[model samples]
Target: MRKNIMNRLPVILPVPAPPPPAHRAEPVLDLAVPVFNEEADLEPSVRRLHAHLRETFPYPFRITVADNASTDATPLIAARLAAELPEVEWIRLAEKGRGRALRAAWSASSAPVVGYLDVDLSTGLTALLPLVAPLLSGHSDLAIGTRLAPGARVVRGPKREAVSRCYNVLLRCTLSVGFSDAQCGFKAVRRDAAARLLPLVRDTGWFFDTELLVIAERAGLRIHEVPVDWVDDPDSRVDLLPTALADLRGIARVGLALARGALPSGRPSRSYAVPVTVMALAHLLLYAALRPAAAAQAVNALSLMACWVLAQPVLGRPPLPAPPALPALAARLAVTAGSLALLRHAAPGAGLRAELAVLAAAHLSLALPVAVARSARGGRRCRTGSAAS
Candidate 1:
């Protein structure tokens, strides 16, 4: 019996180990610099930034120079610096633009917080501490040095300053983005914030700066715009007129997006749903009552209902499959039934018309639901994201 039991020994089953618990490592702060043809500027800027980092930062830090397809010694200079400085990381992108290079570099960094400052360092290091402190303290997710921030000084030209003011005003009117200096090249982002932002951003040139800030603001990230001491670099690459024109066009794009109620990051806007629904119902009822057989009227009614169904799903409401037929017909029938019921109590055509008009107006009133939902969603989006827009 013992021999038989030994021979019948069963195979051992290996127990699967549970997954290691995810450790939330403290976020490391990283400094990113965008380089173009500034071989002359790179070394001096690196030295200055190194000095600033040594003097101020107590945490582990890394400096990344994103070489934007430079045709000069920028990459070589960066490599040399990286070799000498353990904290320095050199990133070379084949794309030949400051914005493109910066995006690539920022993406490559594993640090939880990252930011870009101009190679010229027009904004002072003193200002940078305040800008990044909020992020370090966990009070903000992003920081931007604002030249136009209240009480900030510009130790340079008044003409360019005037132009900046006018440009901001134009942006305010068009995009409704509320940044004091959206054009400021000095900006920082928390890793999660950057992850959400960089993908949605498409502009790879100078316009990238504005577009990024716009997207950040809309995403509801807490962006602290620190007032900074700014001095214009004598060798600035920006062409004011052309840059402004491009930014204006960007603002126009922003306006168009807003009109369609498209936000940069998050779930679709639910505010337009009820208004769209009301518009659809109104069109159908109006067509049936006035021009029932008109081709244009039928088309308009059908189009409105179709738009409503499409919008309803986006607005967090159930969608009707046959919107043009079922939803539209239902609205029309409701109006017709009401109008007929009222017609029996008064004048032939007058009472019916009045009843239809009142009903249409009541249907149009559903816009309030959309407005409230949009406002609440916008507020939530802001609290969770960045103070960018």
Candidate 2:
């Protein structure tokens, strides 16, 4: 009976599929576009970009457009482009934001060299070649098309130029950002870098580009800034004051992140002394508020504050060698000033209480390490080490 049953059943084993080939995958250059309500410029810009890509970049290429929940004919145009161009694909973003859309598109694309150019083609199609060249050649991990550099030419109105200069100056001074012009939208990165940056960044609005570049810089990646001919599109989406304020906030965030060593190095330090300097100035302001002639006293106080703040970092403790607590104190002061500054700017009188609170917090933050050190030394003196043991 067992032999008969075994013979009746046809033994079947599943066929094993071969493993994927071990050959290295070729890196494909993808031009990632974040398109919002760009219905008017959609076709023309895409055509121009396609033509440029065809003429230049003699490698595999694909265009990924993240259609940012456009309210106009932008989505329709993107769908049509995707259908017409084999190398083109559209990623629909439910929310609308230039930076957000671009990030979505880059993440969805399957190319190695990911890049984004303004929908208006402000940086010109000619600049695209150099933008992605560094990534392709393996010379640089990221490339940015800069408009304010020496060889770059900007054909915008005087107002735009003035605003751009002022905005950049503020960023440089506050964040100590090394980039000449961080706002230029035409930037590209290697697939690895793009993949790394897309998830690390949180801002999805106009400030996204700035955050991306800063993160890249902090990651110790070589960012090549390429000068290009940039003419401002009359229909630029940026609002003057609001956008300026937003960018300032972004700069501050980037600076704080950098100081905290949050991006790549992952080290902790209180090296942000600028905020302490600002706090010292605030103290001076408070003194002046009480007495007009107190400015001299305030100045002396500020000088003392500066010296104390500077000395801890520059001069290490003799007995114990460790990171200077100056950075830690400065960081605390900066945190306080930033909060107070925002409140003061947004709601002038409401920040007074906040200012007092922050000042107290700053003093505590600065004093803790010294207090701890002193306490430890006193405890050491009170005990005979081996005898206590």
Task: Return the lDDT, model 2, position 43.
Answer: 87
Question: Stretches of candidate 1 above 4 Å error?
Answer: 1-27, 264-389
Judge candidate 1 at residue 83 and give its lDDT: 72
Residues 146-234, model 2: lDDT tens digits: 87889998899999899888777756655556788888879888878888888878788888988887777766788898999998998
Query: Each prediction's TM-score against the native?
Result: 0.62, 0.65
Candidate 1: worst-modelled 10 consecutive residues by lDDT: 11-20
Superposed on all Cα atoms, model 2 deviates from the true structure by an RMSD in Å of: 15.5
Instruction: Please report how far candidate 1 places residue 347 from its true position, in Å.
Output: 61
Instruction: List the RMSD of every prediction in angstroms.
Output: 18.6, 15.5
lDDT tens readout by residue for model 1, 222-281:
778888889999778888877765665565455445435565544333233423443444
Residues forming the 10-long window of minimal summed lDDT in candidate 2: 9-18
TM-score between model 2 and native: 0.65
Give me the runs in candidate 2 sitting further than 4 Å from their true place: 1-27, 266-270, 274-389
What are the clashing pairs of model 2? 270-327, 270-328, 271-327
Clashes of each: 9, 3
